[model samples]
Target: MKKFIIGLFALVGFSAQAAIINISTDQASYNVGDTITANVWIDIVELQGSNLAQPFIGGFVMSLMADATSLSYNDGSIMFGDKLGAGALSALLPVGFGVYSIQSAAFTPSVFTLQAGLTSFELFSLEFTALSSVSDALFGLTASVSEFGSFVGTPVSTASTEFSVEATSVPAPSTGVLALLACFGMMVSRVKARR
Candidate 1:
């Protein structure tokens, strides 16, 4: 029993060191009320030479978290294409106050990529509109491999990262005095044209 437990620990440690889940935003910065898309991906190919070759070998499920105070989840933004065909299982919900969760999973024996160079699996694209009252806000969304994180029923490796989301105040229009200018222009045009 002691040897078995030690082996299990070793296995988990090795797998944990294999792959990682990364996050990225469509834009580096956004203005207040501006909608933004966040992407979660399995960045295995990036770790190609560092001991672990192919981080994600098969289909897997990922659960992500966001800060509801700074952002609100948009409906129907998740897109996984053919590999991910979960009817209602893939969804975004408020699992807690001020904290929201997104679930994404895919299963396909024909769509496995565990070889060679940097391969990226786009798990999902989530859209969120900034909702903070402050002039600016900067935060990050995090992700983790769910218990269902597996490649064809076998446990895979994963790591998580905090991607930044910055929101700034939208610039005001510069044409506030356009009406007055237009009236003056009309008068000047009439005067010039009449003369």
Candidate 2:
């Protein structure tokens, strides 16, 4: 019975170290032509009172999907976070359509490892321009970490968020402005007739 209890505790400790992916935007809503900044984060903190050491990640591949019609991805706007450490190589792979793949890895396995800690670290960020107003502009993400400390790979849960875009309103012309425009039109017509 004691052996079974120990095995159960080990299973629970292993599950607690799984990474979590998070997606967030700078604002709750946006307007047409406005820029939106989306940030991706990974949380690998171990559960409190767990004896297992936090696992470090050597690299990660993340794919982001956005509504192409409503939000246009900004070229050259992919930025990696410092947690990846120096000498980390990254690339922005345009998969065509509306999916973007971001891959980053340490040049040398021993050069750096996303250190284990009690907090989350920023994985990367992307920028997009609001093309048109939409009730819900959806963004989706899927990611996995490779070369985890002594482990082959770890899969992170998929995450998504919705953004709203509202159209910018143009003020209507006032009555006085409309009357002035009519007077100007009449004077121009009169001059043209004289000529």
Candidate 3:
């Protein structure tokens, strides 16, 4: 009985320390001039032996790196997750070429807290426009979370994904355009037949 209790405590402690940061894009490929959206998610194991261990999140900062030449950061496109709640403060700053810093925090301690359970929640999202064609372009994301009460910061490992951008192709004529051209051609044919 003693050994079983010790083992159970160990398992709960291990699960409590487990957290993951995930980054994902809307699509695996894009065309030049297409908008690309990347989402950041955080999954925390909050159930510690049937009790919720939800932490009060003070703030978080995320760094994103992309190919500047092939992708243009869409200014003012950083959106905070709903879980952060309204009245949250946020900012987007350009760290360097093709690099950006996204920061967000709750107004007060009671504003933002991690939800209980194993559910994965979105932290934020960013948008970029494909400027030029590139093969196997990579977008890298890393982040850190700050606990409000403890003031302890935990760094999340970097997550990255690769995608391709193809050159934009010329669009074919639309059906409306085709119908207009056909009507003009018929009018011209009638005029010539009358002559």
Candidate 4:
């Protein structure tokens, strides 16, 4: 029972540090028409004495809001491939025009589990298209991660993150192509005039 008691205390100590889920785009800035990728990550502040040989992440659910004017929701944007939940069950719901929720859980009697240690792994990634230069300039998103707690059955903490999209100037299409098209138009106009 000594090991069990130590493990319990270790869990409590880890939980007290406050687990925070941080959300960020792969790039600090993007250009119009670029594919934007947002990554969700969890960070543990300290690891003292969680005498756990293996730790279970259990499951996670997240919700976020986006700017519909500059963004459109696309299916298959969020993905979790046996990272947190092996053979996990997951669902993505469009709560509103600019809102969404994602919930995932492991198989019952076969739930996903991670070895106990410092926690820093990607939960999932969100894909988006920079519809306008405006949205790219201010791509804003919010998310909250939860499910685990500080007990034998429940073993995790929760936190939230707010992030914004940064965008670079929108570039025009190929300049060479545009120049060729202009030359072609001039040649046709000259031939017509000569006729």
Give stretches of model 3 more than 4 Å off: 1-19, 46-52, 111-114, 171-195
Per-prediction TM-score to the true structure, in the order listed: 0.54, 0.73, 0.71, 0.58
Looking at candidate 4, what is the lDDT of residue 184? Answer: 100
Q: In model 1, which runs have C-alpha deviations exceeding 4 angstroms?
A: 1-19, 46-63, 81-89, 113-118, 133-195
Q: How far is candidate 1 from the true structure (C-alpha RMSD, Å)?
A: 10.8
lDDT of 1 by residue, 45-90 (tens): 5434466545433344444555667777777766653434333245
Q: Give the per-residue lDDT of model 2 (tens digit) for 59-162.
A: 78888899999899999998888666677888889897889988888655542444645367788898999999998998899888775333344566788989
Write the residue-wise lDDT of candidate 3 on 1-195 in tens digits: 999999999999876644367788999999999999988877654312254565556668888899999999888888888666676688889999999988887765444444434366788888999999999988998888876654556786678888999998999999999999999999999999999
- What TM-score should be assigned to candidate 1? 0.54
| Model 3 residue 143 CA deviation in Å | 1.1
Per candidate, the number of residue pairs that clash is: 1, 0, 0, 5
Candidate 2 residue-wise lDDT at 113: 46
Clashing residue pairs, backbone N/CA/C < 3 A, model 3: none
**Candidate 4: 10-residue stretch with minimal lDDT:** 150-159
The residue-level lDDT of candidate 3 at 3 comes to: 100
True lDDT of residue 22, candidate 4: 61
